[model samples]
Target: MSEQADLKRTPLWDAHRRLGARMVPFGGWDMPVQYATGILAEAKAVRTTAGLFDVSHMGRLEVHGPTAREALESLTPNVIGKLALKKGHYTLFLNERGGVIDDLIVYCQEPNLYKLIVNASNTEKDCAWIQSHLPAGSVLTNRTPDTALLALQGPLAVTIMAAAGAPEASEIRRFERVAVRLFNNPAWAMRTGYTGEDGFEIQCSATSAENLWNALLRVAGPNLVPCGLGARDVLRIEAAYPLYGHEIDDDCNPWEAGLGWVLKKTEGFIGAEALARLKESQARQLVGLTMETRSVARQGATVLAGDRPCGEVVSGTFSPNVNASIALAYVDRDVTDETLTVESGGRRQNAARTPLPFVDLPVARKKKPAGLTSTASL
Candidate 1:
């Protein structure tokens, strides 16, 4: 079969094409890399205003049955039992060696039930791995086929969402999910996003995707830009959010990846023993790098401390928000030099150690009601 025919199309694929998006192959799916407004414009819209993203290419899996909680806790490092109803948490699925299988967000919908949003490329592999570890009375179901996800991100995201039909989205605390009417259709809205901005990741039926997309655009008018993967990548890179293949993989552990914060305590989970054995001295830690110029470093770029190669860049780009080049790299723990050099495509750019986030964005888009506590506060 032709490669194009083999690539999966999202429910809103036609909508994206109609908006003059540049289609590209990503994770075995035909996705848009950028719209005609270009990556910079789309990213600016997201940072300064709002942008809507059709993220249907991601995988959604449902874990049901009585043993769901027990089975899930065994596969990840986070304590799954602590998730309250309608609440979710970001976590990593780990192997016995403490390597990350994937990083995902798990939401508790009911007793013994969970909805996991995994990376698009790792859907099948993650499913198989989870199934192998699941004990009796636990069940796993792939819900990607019937689900469509829309991420409306930026500082103005909540305002735009309320104007688009989901006023209750403003009240949804970070990490909390609620049922809402979006574009006059029933859907679930989660106050979670990857861009380090206030936003909502709305889950709706695949059948309603196109109509909802159109309605959101019409209601948002000129305020909301339809962003593509290019802008999405830039936004996430600026936020220092890890991508599956670049910043994280099966061989990368939480300690080395700067993901130790996800674990409340490391004793009861699958990789607990392995994680407990990890020490700071033995870890190759992830760090943020700010380049002196606009010279962007690509993944696999060698990071040098003086003349010696000490690490490799995992993700990098020219951050529009910062108006300069930035990157994330895994540097050897023994290297204490504040000044480093990143060599990419044979070009060496001087860099300095920067904090994790290149841009400081809001964690909570809107204030919660008096009784609700934000996940950001935790």
Candidate 2:
């Protein structure tokens, strides 16, 4: 219970409490980690049907003006110049040493306007970093406090959104966004999600959150249930999405985390040179592991080969959908693509290094038209 005076609360705080959520402190906010249905149930719901999450805790920053695009391109490694309007992609904020500051989604809304959705815990730090690097004619605004974000995820999410009166939802492709009016209030519907499911992340004003939430629930009725952080964590881990502190941090670079695809060396961004060097000398590689036994390997659990430690678990869970214990771990570069072991519940269990994304994503990547450049999908 984060009852501290300084702890922040989202606009949906009251609704969560009313629905019997188990509140806990997350990123300095009193957030719901699970509701009466519990983490596993919520995780299953999202995997099978649909689940709604109050992700208002995330930070939303708007940047626009003459040099906004150039300034943003200079801050991150991704090629912002190629990001078409209404398109968004996952990228990272990194330090000069190629260390991750945070991973975020950047959306190019218009010619000179963009929106950055960043992690809640590092919102202030990210804002300050942006301020320090602001280009002469660009403007930055923190829109977190006045916004409410909801993730409607799963196979049936499209149906739910359609029922909620957003028929344009089906027209939005993955990584694309559209400005729309929902429940008579202005909103942005983006075909993106943290969970591995096909979904839409809806952003609306804080003042309208309650009504919107209620309307969504009424429309989505038995198909969509409220989920919380616990389920969110399990879903993300199952999807092989790295959490900031768990799989990456200030001391880690993108290459070590298996996210090298997003790094563009030619862009010459802040950490480009350092990342290029580290890519040559990369020592560790993040990989997915499936345990042979039923025991769950937890974060920080030492991965062993015979008697020697080779790596450690960064994220782990008993996946209900997979019907097995799965985890993400970092091992020495030479130790990757091999079977290993981890001590769980005082027993050593055999673990096999598996390809990332323990589960297939609900929406497959749209194949580029033959001979066309790949900018649209990135």
Q: Give the per-residue lDDT of model 1 (tens digit) for 1-378.
A: 589899999999999989999999999899999999999889889988899999999999999999999988878877789999999999999888788899999999999899999999999999999999988998999999898999999888889888877766887989998999976789999999888888999899999999988898888888899999999999999888899998888888887777888877667777788777764445587889999988888899999999999999999888889898889999888888999999877788899999878887788235577467555445
Q: Candidate 2 lDDT, tens digit per residue, 1-378?
A: 336667899999999999999998899888999999989899999989999999999999999998999989999988888999999999999899999999999999998999999999989999999999998999999999999999999999988877877877887978898987777678999999999899999999999998898888888888899999999998998899989999999899998987888886444678877876787898888989999976889999999876788889999998877888999998888874478989856779899888879888766556568568566334
Clashes of 2: 0
Every candidate's lDDT? 0.88, 0.89
Off by over 4 Å in 1: 364-378
Residue 358 of model 2 has an lDDT of: 89
Question: Could you tell me which 10 consecutive residues in candidate 2 have the lowest summed lDDT?
Answer: 369-378
TM-score of every prediction relative to native: 0.95, 0.94
